[model samples]
Target: MSTVPRYIREYVDVNVDFDKDGRMLPKTLIWEDGHRYEIDRIKAIQPAPALKAGGQGDRYTIVIKGHERYLFFEHNADYGDEKIGKWFVERKVAP
Candidate 1:
């Protein structure tokens, strides 16, 4: 029998800094349980493709202060012409 990995993904609320080109960059992270973590440094910010065509928004991998875990952000397309996408976070775990 195989055991499932303990790491389950979670959606989180985040505060970030954006460039003039409107890129999503993480600055602060707030969990659903109300714990806040300020980003002391960004270890990496790689773009994950949302669609084959383009412009569906992006996904990012970031590391915050005091933790060696991988934090993710998914910025999705507009919901019903709202002119803004949604953001979500997921923590990665080693298998």
Candidate 2:
């Protein structure tokens, strides 16, 4: 049996800040269970596809609690804020 973990797109509520030049800077994210995680720093931002899941967006390389993770901003999803779009993380799910 293949032991590779399955990934699912898990949408989360994110707090963001915009610069004067309209650049987005993500501050923190709240999970479905109300757990919050602060983004320590952004390593890089680039347009990439979620290979684990199934989507495409600007992937943000962020560090949280000394661990790095990819945070995706799928610009097409209308999650109450059309101007900002929705944020998601490729979460590992059990098969």
Candidate 3:
């Protein structure tokens, strides 16, 4: 019998913002195909060591540009698992 490798879920960073109280807010994450999804549910968040010296540590956000849209993500403070916030491109896509 042949075994198939399990596909791992991947996420990309978008943007990060601070509340008036300075608490990090939930981030967004878009699909590889530029589809938008909500991450209304979060589990936990923790600080992590820098992957490398002077690497700015692991608390940061990322932006990904897709053919049809742009995706945004950032470190979350509600989930132990890594996740990003996402939204659709400002412009509408053509059918």
Worst 10 residues of 1 by lDDT: 49-58
Kindly report which residue stretches of model 2 are placed more than 4 angstroms away from their true locations once superposed.
Answer: 77-84
Q: Compared with the true structure, what per-residue lDDT tens digits does model 1 show for residues 1-95?
A: 88554444466677878889986677877888999988776666666643322332355545565665455554444556753554555444665
Query: In lDDT terms, which candidate is top?
Result: 2
**Candidate 3 overall Cα lDDT vs. reference?**
0.38
Arranged by lDDT with the best first, the candidates are: 2, 1, 3
Error of 2 at 62 (Å): 0.3
lDDT of 1 at 9: 49
Every candidate's lDDT? 0.59, 0.92, 0.38
- Cα lDDT, model 3, residue 16: 45
lDDT tens readout by residue for model 3, 1-95: 86543322244443446789975654555456776555443343344433321122233232323222222223355666654332222222332
lDDT of 2 by residue, 11-79 (tens): 999999999998899999899999999999999999999999989999999999999999999895666
CA shift of 10, model 2, Å: 0.1
